[model samples]
Target: MRDEWNAPWGSIPELVRWAAVRYADTEAVVDCGGRVRVTYAGLGARVERAAAACLAQGVRPGDRVGIWAPNSLDWITAALGAVSAGAVLVPLNTRFKGAEAADVLRRSGARLLFVTGTFLGTSYVASLRRAAGEGDAAGPLPGLPALRAAVVLSEDAPRSFLTWKDFLASGEGVAAEVVRSVRVPGTAASDIVFTSGTTGRPKGALITHAQSLRAYDTWAELAGLRRGDRYLIVNPFFHTFGYKAGVLACLTRGATMIPQPVFGAETALANVAAERVTVLPGPPTLFESLLDHPARRDHDLSSLRLVVTGAAVVPLSLVERLRADLGVETVLTAYGLSEASGFVTMCRRGDPPEVVAATSGRAIPGVEVRVVSPDGTGLPPGSPGEVLVRGFNVMRGYYEDPAATAEVLAPDGWLRTGDVGVLDAAGNLRITDRLKDMYIVGGFNAYPAEIERLLAAHPDVAEVAVVGVPDPRLGETGKAYVVRRPGSSLTADDLIAWSRREMANFKVPRWVEFVPDLPRNATGKVVKGDLREASGP
Candidate 1:
């Protein structure tokens, strides 16, 4: 058999096929939520069945199939199955409320949706029904005319939805050979990951199958992932890093996947000890929580060996603590965004402690990284400027949004990352600031404009400006300065409580200050730099 790195599979389907035969008996995924374990062979069969089911639902190639749920065994099967059947995967954020998810679904024109029953006390199906209201025509959710079916990944479902068992059984009629006949090419768009940029509206970045395979294959090799190494993936699958680095990387390396739907420090410790989880990738807050948890000494976490963290600032102290306290063999930091296929500069395995803690390492092979000034001139080493990347892994473009795509992608093929950074003498990339007012909240990207737009929906909120404030535990959290409407007796606590219901938990501001008016410039644009300074720690 060809080595995963030397002769990588072209498409996800080809990779799945190869791994199923090569690692048939190897433990593939361990879903703690349902206490299920499947081998690579089992996963492959399940994916084929899932593909057949999609075909049974009349899903055609290039059709958009969206999965709006948390991490689980069923999620993998369905997502991979949809892709194997020639559909472009669209993973919605599990943290999204009903309205937030519907907006993306409408924009993408998704045909089939696989939604969870109820997650974290809220019934997703009910929330979706409320958000969609009554449709003027047919389909599971009338508000989404393009959506042909909605499958609930649970035993029971609402009136018009299909249960997990029923959905799988529908495809039993199709022969396996028929499913194998449809081979997806490497150039076909694999997934469209939607990210909120400066516009505050989420745009889908179209990434091809080749880009996904090549990037994560490199990610697996760089991280030293190998056969039998169990990985505990806490990152949400909706994001590119979570799906590409967590799932796809494991497949290439024959590693076992342990999906954590939600992150709780205690639960994670238990899983690490119980499952002998060797690889753990998440935001720095996750490590901080594990390190500080009072019950740390109670668990047998000796099996924990590798950790990969980034997105926000990485402190030297945190790096030392992981190696010293937990006896973790390797702890590395890296940086990437959805636009770059979530694979960029990452510290090598044997790098010194100082380098790993300080900078996101040199660019990956076949990719070029350059820092440039506002005048489009290349900046010298140590000068912080806009980071530009020209890479095979860079996304094709935003799906069908040519004007928006043209803004960031230059004609010369250099992708303007909009992130301010400096390249040291050794080419290590250290991100200093953002051209766009975006922040990282426990690994989730939080854009100020997106938060402002959501906050504006409040009836009493006259105006609001959000800035990222440092949190010791969470890398950074949002703090909002608001101007309440006249005669509105809106309290900070009141707005905070209301925000919990309206937006994702990470996007919700941790602190709210009432202001007379927002600080604005001559052009009337909100001067967020001033707000960020005023909200300083």
Candidate 2:
């Protein structure tokens, strides 16, 4: 996986080892939720132990390893360990159901899985076991034929699954020098971030070590992240922004991480005041909630120095409020997607409030962004068209889906971002519409096709279509138009309840309308434009 462009300290293990020496005494990670703190030296030691555990469990280079957990010290150690063992990291959505998690694990042929015991009241282990317990695979989860082992990240585990303690203890026998000399994931696919495409199938975007490091190094630089800055990471670790911009960026700049598994304005304020958090980056809703929170004035939010927000259109008033109301030093907005290695454009620090609020700033270094017509011709500035990108930051391709890969990525190194945006005369990019009908719910990309696919499985749903509708809190949420089967009396409440149990929370449609039939165009395609109009502004 090594490449000429791969940095010596690019990979997780390499970064851990290097940071351990450079910032040994500096606070690295403080899990306020768990009441745990780990310095760089401690992170390095723990990661090394986890990597040894990975080897002891028979993980090999190029093997698919999955982590299904929330933001925590255990999640970081487990994911870094898998990569340190030369395994491709596959982070599962914490909001995912057992079925969805198993679907990815099975498709990726994950050899090992690290799962949390329980989170937000549901037992993740119980959910996964029930979902994957009936298959012919002789492993811990019988349904997953390729999964050889499951490590529970808690004190207790089923007899079949290995506890986190036992898993690490097995690696104690492995020589330290051997672990040090072990393979470092370089230019190879360090991770396969799974994203649902317009076709309703999950596609894994392959990003290499060099690409991630180079891009985020450029990101941390552009974002003006500095050493000793305490960052409160509210973004889920599964997304590229969280893993790369949140974790990787901190490592690059020696910033301390304060991971929050679930977001609550009250909790966030407490952390900012107590931990002296100086850096905060998240979706616009994060800032909005914090500003509107009843107890906001109770906490000493004066320590907040920076905020980077995007994934939805940022309001000019919101930007003004963050600066004026909160007295924040700097605020910026940016845009990205999974196919583009989770980054493409960002606002510069000194940009005016109008530019920062109006558009996702110019492309990061080494990347070319274009507004093109349907015929593939470039458009003039201010003319909206499909957004296209090309650069070292682009992903290798969608893992094992060359056809889908070919659909977006051209042979000459261009990636069709499937987003409609306008380029300002100054080269700033402002995204307008999602060409694939995808929407953002609290910074998570939700494809309508994916949600429709999930809904279509219901026995009562004879036909279904989903569209993004504006929401005050979450930015945007799904609204489903469904047709019931003959004589079926499935109510919206019933379907919504079923969806909560079946799909991730973000994908569950917040609004459901029982329609006679979906409006179709001349080509028999559901005209989403009419649906959005009917949904109202």
Candidate 3:
């Protein structure tokens, strides 16, 4: 284990101190909804207060605190607060139903939960209560023995749940100072980030703080993130891409962050113009939506100095359109996963247009990437193989899953990325496909196996297989082929509706086909490659 003094700013609180010293009065975070602005100093104080509150609740070092909220000021505050309190922050997807959300909360062993009362039209508190096995009329979560308390983010405080204002108010005066001094030894960059797996289970990738900060610093240095530069964050905070690239990077570099709760292309464009955002990074879908918007012509995006797209394979045409129509000088492509603390490979700022469009760029500083065959042998350039990365940015291992960790992280510390890619002579990475049946829908990982498992649970379904099909808008959408049981008459609409109820909205299959039997290979494996190809464009 690395010494705390030698560690690269071991906690988010440390990073906050750095930013506060440099840009104390600058607007650190801006929410356009209520036009709420939090200056660096003010943000630091709130973080300290929240941290104190966590400590008051007996949250010690390495304790898991679940953050089940949407993209908001409170979400960021709670995340930083947990880190400051020396607790491992576990961010839950807001789209999850009660059962799904509870599973993550229970599995993570979260002692406290911070959730919004409501987001958009969804009631998060209601969902969480139901998931906790406390039905609508029930008081507190029934089975969450580990959960000490629930803090609701609302103007009006609930009877059973503690309100955000009251929670923050609990950490006043000298208590905040004591919380600030409480430091843990092992709170390095290598912590766990629970990402959804193809098998419907969430795997906690152990990414170190060093790896995360390296990604932030590398991108900041390469992208020229100067002080006073504003960034527009529309990407959800749960994903590593958004957390590391969007939030941490900005916080580390003294850049202002303008967060949008939900993504609306027109609203994003307006915010960009309003905030004079200099650096913007999101999935290609966001940019595509912006380009397709009729109002884009009227919006002024000239302030954007750098535009980055990653998480999914970016279309070359989209790259061309941004440069041609939007006048974006620096268009970059990045490639990484939850295990690598966001991005390990990214195109440099001044690279030639073709190179930027074709590759995931060179490995960032201190990171080593190699393309290797299935037998663990190194492959020559241009030969596609599993991309293995070993670096400061590589995760320590999966949390508490030694067998799963050993399978991916070799004896030599190389982390098998499970992504099929080829390294060019210049070491640029071009991804082919994922080794696991994982597909990206609008930059979010949608595991076909997970969706298939959910679809099979439907009463009318006998068996089902889900595969990714080409989608112009989302990049890829799930298409399921089902074999109904004897005497069962289930239509595609029925399966779709069932999926919408059983799983998150994004995991629902866009198209469903009834087939007598699924094509299988000689080895008795369902041939998804054939299904995807046969589905057609």
Candidate 4:
């Protein structure tokens, strides 16, 4: 029998081609800055040009190509093009510093990098150059020996980088036939997304084209996404939520994608009024800001039809406010991770505010979810335990790290999702907490281990342990329990300032406590429980 859950498109390139042919004149994407717009046909052509450019740059099948840029029209074209040309796309978080991004490129062995020249008043190319150092005029840069080229996406490229226009221009020498013939199998790795590991680094999760298409097809349906819907995507593109759920979902349904590089209440409200955006999805903090904005009622927001929020607890009042105040018809909450292709469960449209706010809803079709005990047995209903997932949506494996992959992905295809949740009798999942020590700062994952590593680099920080503490605005923010070195008079403010420059904004600690020593247990591990209690209200 034929599979009912199989996606109509076999691969990412195939999906774009199908959309171009089916909706040639339909607007596919619009830059929120009013800089560029493209129809389905136009997007298809640009993607092919990008693919041809990759071919010209010698990107081979199975090779990794990295994009270290924020949400932009070129980000979409470059990422799709790289994957279309049979190279695995590695999306580096735009919030990362040069050192952080270089770590991913080095680990992924990416040979080419597409970076933004300037964004949010910082020159990323310059930061990268500094990170690479001026080498001894010969030996490889610190950790990026595999990266051979840097293409800057900007009006004026830096002296050391290739301009976006020039990068595309290089494709002129490569024939269209050659680009079209470079096809990756549906099951082949399309992207290697890096998520924070407890080991003070990040692990690459290998995802396939078919997995992405199938998973988001279900996501779009449950979220009430449809043809001609104007989707204002505020989520960062490096995440699976934006790249797969936001961008690919739009492509699958013929929705017009409007990428918002920055999330601000006034800015998002302005775009909604101007673009008549029907679909808006973000973290609860986004909606809270929009609702609490001083000019909340100033804009004509009647065009909004659907609102989806997650990555933290969804306030019932927020859902009610969107419907009562903003006149939004549907507001939903979802639960997923990068390992699950960014899709697992979603609160269906029209679900009651209580259910929508309280639970993560049931698993999508073709995916099985269970709450298992520590010994690997299924837990009874209403009992919270580790959530385990088994389905096509699960990632192939942690890229090139079988040992790490084995810890999570079982031999029988079940994935050990390090999240604690209870499955009600109705199959709805109410997320209680996390099995892993990860905190959500405005929908961004701030792994304690990752933050601790960066803090340990501080000159005055002799010892440090990071933990998540409650925050009214960001759901949870990091609090660093630090022990200063002898004779070192480093203040909490000093470490906070240092963190701002050393790591991503979300991962930076919001609070710091200077203690003489860390409380430890018999096992010699720092007692995080004591730290959390000490960081009390």
The deviation in Å at residue 56 for candidate 3 is 1.3
Off by over 4 Å in 3: 1-8, 135-139, 157-159, 185-191
Question: lDDT ranking from best to worst?
Answer: 1, 2, 4, 3
> Which is better, 1 or 3, measured by lDDT?
1
122-150 per-residue lDDT for model 4 (tens digits): 88877887787643323234447787667
Candidate lDDT values, in order? 0.91, 0.90, 0.80, 0.88
Lowest lDDT 10-residue stretch of candidate 3: 1-10
Q: What is the lDDT of candidate 2?
A: 0.90
Q: What is candidate 2's lDDT per residue for 299-397, written digit by digit as tens?
A: 989989899999999999999999998889899988888888899999998999999999999988788999999999999999999999999888999
Regarding TM-score, does 2 or 3 come out ahead? 2
The regions of model 4 sitting more than 4 angstroms off are: 1-3, 135-143
TM-score of 4: 0.97
Clashes of 1: 0
**Clash numbers, per candidate:** 0, 0, 7, 0
TM-score of each: 0.97, 0.97, 0.95, 0.97
| Candidate 2 Cα deviation (angstroms), residue 149 | 0.8
* Candidate 4 worst ten-residue window by lDDT: 134-143
Compared with the true structure, what per-residue lDDT tens digits does model 1 show for residues 7-57?
558899889889999999999999965389999999999999999999999
TM accuracy, model 3: 0.95
